[model samples]
Target chain A: MVNSWLELGAQKKDTPVKHNYSIFRRNCLMGIVLAVLLMSGPQRSWGQSEKPSIDFFSGFEVGLYDFYFYQKYNVVFNLTPGFKWNMGNHWQLAGQARLTVINQLSNDVRRFYPSMLVLSKELKAGPVYLKGSVGAFSNSRYGFDLKAFLPVTPWLAFEAQAGLTGLLTMAGGWGMSPMGRFTGTVGGDIYLSRWNTQLRGVVGKYVYTDWGFQAEAMRHFNHATVGLYAKWNNIAGQLGQEGVSLTQSLAKGMDGGFKVTIMLPPYKRTHRTVNFRPASHYSLTYLVRGMAQYRDANQLYYTDPEENMRDGWFSRDLLKWGSHTMEPDFIYKGKEETE
Target chain B: MKRIKISYILLAAMVLLPSLSHAQQYNGTSGFLHIPSAEMSHEGDARMGVHYLNKALLPDTGFLFQGEKYNTYDFYLGITPFEWIELSFTSTRRKDTRAVTGEVGFWRKDRYASIKIRPLREGRYHPAVAIGFNDVGTTAFNKERTDVQLYFTNIYVAATKHFGFGGNELGVNLAYRHYFRNYNDKWSGLVGGLSFRPAFFPQGRAIVEYMGNEFLIGADALLWQHVLIQASLIDFKYLNLGLCLQLNMLGKKYVVAER
Candidate 1:
């Protein structure tokens, strides 16, 4: 069982006992020499040929926000469930499993859990695609990401990503104290899968400091799927406390909302999978208007006058597949199913 | 004792000569815990660590916990012969924690080495440079101390609909550090920050740093399915809060290949 949970995590307690047992026996002898070099290298032809098929997705997402300058705008909710697997032939392999819940319409309410691993590749013509990702966020920090995508057709697409995240301490514990940062994003995605709709727009900048923008639109009928989201963040310079120079900090606001999803598939389909159909989803979002401003350029303080509007619901029954599975199902009834 | 057996055979030949060559495109594993700075006076120190990176261990090994005013407990090892080169080895058993009190059990040990560089390649906002060296031995009233360290890195880029967000990550970074004697002069300064990972926490993230002057806020919560949980809170001048945990070694691949 994964080497007895890595031998009980090398007997826990801040590990390091004999160098984590020689790094778990050198990663189990490098996983038996990469499984005997992929069972004696060189050998193809195994399901799906043609080399132009990249489709993998794992779901579960919940979000709600209303933080316009901290005045009655605190209703942040999140629940992410991910998995995106696509290999060779074209290339795409993503993964996810996140959970976040923050309620601050008034103040105090936090929770988070993140998991990710992604790699995407596709370029020919223009719809460009190139991605890379590294994970670790709830186990205790360490992240890396990269991105590039451009598809002005087949729906619409455009993207960009950056990286460097932190956390790696061994003396404190509220979660460790190592917060490194650096990020950038630009977005575009619009797919109307025959009214199944999907519209997105993003704009962010955290360089000289801060700026935010977000938009979402989803509509998938015949089982249920409805969404509409928006966002606008601010804070683009001057911020130094003890030594002064708060430069008005900066804070703007906006948030619209509407989410209604209902999907519950799976009665029994023993086999015959081309994207295994099994669903169960739910959502409720509502946040009307928000505002913020503690210092606009210098001295103009404005962080009150915040209106109230909040509502965020969530639900997930789990079980949805379709990443090329030939007899996949590791204990579905007893739970436990991952590829 | 023969230089502690040649520093454990050069830290086991710098961690098995990069897994004997080739193999390591992405393999990570992490775990951490370290708490010092109870406002000085040799505060109730504490330590614990773990790390592993692939491509022939580009970055590997580190274990620490030498509390009781540096009584004993410290072990570190990092290697990366190529790909910009990097080497490190730190050992400790204690010798001076405010000039030892009254010899309780007696102890002494130390070691060090470091070198890092990334002259471009691996872009998305590149800039890296590093250098370090340490060897503190002699006991009973000082007598052995070797030092030298310097680093300068930068980051600043953007994504996520330029300003309209959802899922896509947004970027920002600005780093700086300098030290050459003064043995950790107030830990140097100027460390910028800013980050946000959306897309439903694709591994989760939300960081903000501004070192040397204070203001460090962090978050990385991905519990299970590879595991993670890093947290932080720093108030410059002095004031800290931390937490750690991470593990994700190999397994999880696919570097673009779907057309």
Candidate 2:
């Protein structure tokens, strides 16, 4: 009403055709503002239409590792009850509980504690994508992690990842260690969409202070994925206190294995505030390494629970949709096709 | 000419109907008794069940920590993610007759995985062939000593061919298994199996297989389209039983190639 009165006063001064057009434009702007306010309800501010949502995921966590001091292999199976809260604006808070049902883990570690409690955010700036998270994460660590990616083409990309974390064990009770370890990696990926294949390689420092490179070749199905991966760490072939040459490690210290991950049923879910379902994916990896090689500091740790090659959050189709669809040539082609 | 076309259609239906009558083996694979044939189920088929195992079934070719002379329960699950691959996970119990303590049960299950890859398909001129491995990621405990033993690890290559004798069908499976770690010659060398299904009783099958110098004769039947029942006599002494339930991942029937 106040804007209308001001427009009326301006009209009394200049009754021109240009004055009428300006008033018409001002009315349209006011209508948009009013519509936004009405759609957001009384609880939300402008441009914040997304509401906080909750997600419940159920699955089992399988921990298979070589080199148990007493046993040959360490197997830990836990029922994972995960919860996620989407705070909107590309931020989410997720955590899963680890209630050990069966285990042959180190010293028969029986744990019922939080597996992960992290807050992560993702942002896209032009062709660059950035993501960061902070809190207690998987692989028994608590700290901050950051990831950045730049796409060279639709099917090829490069990324850099870094993290700083410390030991976190909840076997008998709350046990913590000094947060002083730093690990980082630079990686590249080549995706072949025709065959639904991915080839990725990452090189840098591992959490065990081992500098190495890991490569993977994965095949993706609609709801399943299978892959083969190899690892080579500089600490593997080291004799005494002196590190061996890179050539020796590459030849004699190489280790590889196969991995299979399958997605459970109910691929689609109803949109609701609270949703609970079984785990979406189950992963089993068979790494070929002896106790000597395992103890040589070629171990690996993870911060993200959903990190994978093909059937992961950042799949080939999704990554391509974000990058390839925005190109000028494809944008014009899309418009033509739509028309 | 029209009558001849109808007769051909009837013959095709009779030939393709038996493919839907496949049942799960005692080891939870898609084949006969203890033998795994090269023919797989639908690509998305998933199966889960339990079996009643007799401790005396493979006495001479058994684990070092053999349990008492009794029956035990074993749980297993299998899935076919692709037409050429079959993956299975099992938690099989090894009886420990030496466990005089009361801290645990008489037997404890050790989880293991197995995979089979069918690379060659049966055509007009060739039989289907598959290669498989059991106990995939097991680490050899105490490699130099006898404290811990690698009990069950076998790698095998199998080929199967189907023959149609009038309205009845017969499948012959030939496989060579190579056992590793503890018992290298337990079920080693060549083995064969036979499966026969009459056209009038397509839901039932007669299976006979030999492994470890022992013959296992069994009868398998499918009930209600999804439940599989098996009863086998191992070496003509011990009785082994199995019951399983399976379904296609999409709640559909078999694929066109198999159908």
Candidate 3:
């Protein structure tokens, strides 16, 4: 099933500059470390020998923004044109540009900005897929964001991202400075029959330890995939209003949305589908290939005539793996030499 | 003798460790996007991608240290229609003024086309090889004038390799560039550098290079796989910051079968 989310928020607040910088640095370091560990994890070995594919497509997105979870409304219209290059070996690079037009009920001036641009690189490392990107709005640095998906099982995967926007808070304030705040989203996805569902617990400065749940059911036609979803959010922080009980937090932040995304095909080697595959690439490939070609270890393979003939087609010793064992008498007897 | 044996034992264990894991697999070469380094990874985006790189500082008022820094923004769009071949268009901002003083009123820009072709994939014994041209258009700030200050054409050959032990990977890049400039001296020398990404955080890298007779050091941080922030120091005195957003254009999909 195809599932995605488009979230936008902005606010401004004055905080201690040193504290903000420290928090940003710490989180940045933590994000990098986590990416490394995830990439280095044990991987499943699903692979296709084919090369990667490339394409360009465009779509439109419309969202109704509800202020105070009430009737106050602002509508946002976005024209998103995207270019994607799936570099067959689990590395995908995509760039997206957003031409956003916002119509606010509170203001007469229609705000339209063609300033949103994003470039992203995604690596499917082992069981975890990590994506990091830089975004620019109006020729200035907008912010940086990262999303990671870790599969616990075939049907369940854990998801998390740095959702550092605090407009989700109720002070009628917004901060558009990206990566300026330290917040994160922690959640999991359940792939049921015909449905992909997400239940997330988000914490940090913005959401203030809130809970969000989303359920999307998607259907595919010949070209496009359409999905409808309803999301409900609950914040652990109290609303400070008098007589507000526990149920108020749950009932107040209800949002229902639907999205129609069309995909045009040539999907043979694209691997952009919802299907999961075993990862073939890892960091150890380099080290193993390097050490295996060390002088003394390579001597055993070249000395034997049959071994040399079998590996002759390959130019580098690192590529001659089958018969380069440490044994001095190792021979290339094919399958019979297994022991 | 004891220390040598211990080192050998450690090296042996490292090579054999991956064999113990039955499930682990090697995906392919991994490295940064755009911001080229001496490290060779055969992997690139499959389609067309656009990136914008900005050089943070240029001296205002022409060489005399007016205590003012000029910002030069470069918009670069690259497309790898084929895996090994990349064609790119770069538009750079150049400052021009015939008046010869303070905050030149005229800003001229030019577009240049370049191509990078990787002839061979990097192996343990051999580096990945590429040949490319920079400032191919020879487009200049002022073509009408008798003097053009910002026009130089260069063709370069580069070799990049990755050396890794466990999770630690270091990329070494060696490049030779031949500069074509008629106004000032001919015969440019070798330009090369090294890049390193820590094992703990592969998303960020530190790079140092000597290009065009100037020493440069910088770092690139990739966030969310889309945004790249680069900060560099040039010639020890000038600091430059570049921010780029990478975007991809996906071709129309044709679904042939229904699962």
Candidate 4:
């Protein structure tokens, strides 16, 4: 069959195959260049930006724990000039220089730290999406992190994540602790399509070597998300290191709170190579500390800057949202699927 | 004679009637003088302010200049992310103070946060009600850095009712303030205030409030709906002043220009 086809193709090769193939290749190249130019900046909305995003960012942090009559507050203004440059082949380099504009901490001058300098890659395994990152992260940690997400059904998804990090602080100079603590989480989510509600539960080992669980219920809105979360940890592993017995660890680790995340405007924009705007989403959490507890037990930090329930952060459903609408519809087959 | 006295009392209450509120309170929520009110700016409403706190209104952390100075300052940024919620971060500069612990400083700064939740809107049948925490978790160390003191920490509920009479308006506010963590609870008790906005001067509010231990009279004016300027007489004796700029980054404009 191959010999017969080769003789037939050799006889036709003299005809105009080469010229037509050259023109077709040239047109495809031009089309790709045109698309890249059109999608260079965050125009009209965040979802439309297809090219690398170089944006100016700012956020504020308030520290209330260090207050005393002598020094009441530490209000730091974080200025992050960051870039997410796609290095191609699903690998990217994202980083930010967190400069301090105002730091009223302990009568000392303001200080700046390097934040979120990571080289990350995205991969797909069958139906699951996986991501790995390495470099300095927020919460003063530096190391490597891995994540996997799978959407088994339209209304359910599972996620697994792990991080090996060490303490890095820029306070009073630069210092970094050895990377030894390994932390990981396993979680699943139930998506209620009709109500635009989601419920999530996760069990994880924290950086402090304590085991814990988190439960959250969130409501999705067009531009915002509101949710309540409860976190509980076993004091056993960490407290045992301090000389306390297993019985003393008990159930003392409990913290619950409400969170609100909102997307800021210019929801849509004209094209530009690099854009300047506020942080895409501002999320605020109000923690409830009961009378008995001196402080919260859970020491959790976000591995990804975009981690939030509003985007269903660790779920594949996020891939279906935003450019079209806040509520994903393609995968959310309502009553028809049940029927 | 007794009937005449009762009639005069009723007339006094009627004259001291009610005012509207936006988020221009001196301590930076919606209210009058040094207290918080049951009002909030629209979602996305943000304000940055600098205030000159009078000596009498300062937290009772005794210093060498406690009675002689009215020069402490503060800068705050407040925003309303939800229509019912208001959040703010404030840093107060304690200037030129010598603590009893033998420590002296020219610029000692303290930071605190405040939150307000407006659950009920004012209607003909009921007043607007709000629950708030002011400096909820603020504690400062003494000069020795050994002793800790909670400063300006308060939890309060405020109710405000607005009465309109041909463009001129009045607002009556009553609240109960509790010291959540502190030894000296100066402004922690029943507090009430009255606000009047004359029809001719729609941009300004004249207010008077008895803040538990002291009486304060103040007036705030909105300039071009964004710039807010305020002046007050603390305990009817010393002067306090404030200036703030309100910025609405998204959604609708924070204030409707009545003109």
| TM-score for chain A in each prediction | 0.26, 0.72, 0.48, 0.68
Q: 1 or 4, which is superior by DockQ? A: 4
Instruction: For candidate 1, write residues A1-339 as lDDT tens digits.
Output: 101222233245445557645654654454345334333422331222222332223334343232322121234454545543444433444444434554333232225433444343332322344333344322233344445656566676676666444333221212322223455677886675444456777776532234566677754443334455655455422234343344333222344434444434442233212343332344444443322221111111001011001111000111111111112212235333322
Error of 4 at A173 (Å): 12
- Candidate DockQ values, in order, are 0.01, 0.06, 0.01, 0.10
Worst 10 residues of 1 chain A by lDDT: A306-315
State the lDDT of candidate 3 residue by residue for B1-259, as single tens digits. 5634543454333333321000000011122222233332212222122222223233223322235434555555443433465555554555445233435532444445565677887776999888766554342223344454433345667788867766655677777766445432232567677776556556556667776456766565545545545555555444454454432333222211110
- Model 1, C-alpha of B90: deviation from truth (Å): 13
RMSD of 4: 16.3
Model 4: lDDT of residue B75: 83
Give the worst 10-residue stretch by lDDT in candidate 4 chain A.
Answer: A330-339
**Candidate structures ordered by TM-score, highest first:** 2, 4, 3, 1
**Deviation of model 1 at B228, angstroms:** 21
What is the full ranking by lDDT, best candidate first?
2, 4, 3, 1
Tens-digit lDDT string for candidate 1 (B31-120)? 111111100000111112222211111111111124322213334433332334333333333333223354333233333322334444
Per residue, candidate 3 scores C-alpha lDDT tens digits across A115-148 of 3344444455565666554443222223455667
Q: Model 3: residues >4 Å from true position, as ranges?
A: A1-339, B1-69, B96-106, B139-152, B182-187, B247-259
lDDT of 2 by residue, A1-339 (tens): 101222234344656657545654554454355334333333222123235677787788777554432232466788988887767654668887777887775453556777788777555545766566677777676666767778887688888887766556565556554444578889988877665567889898866667878888766655666677777776664533345555665655577666777767665445466767676578877655644454434444444555544433332222453212321111112133110
Answer with 1 or 4, whichever has the higher TM-score: 4
Q: For candidate 4, give the lDDT of residue A138.
A: 64
- TM-scores of the candidates are 0.23, 0.66, 0.34, 0.61
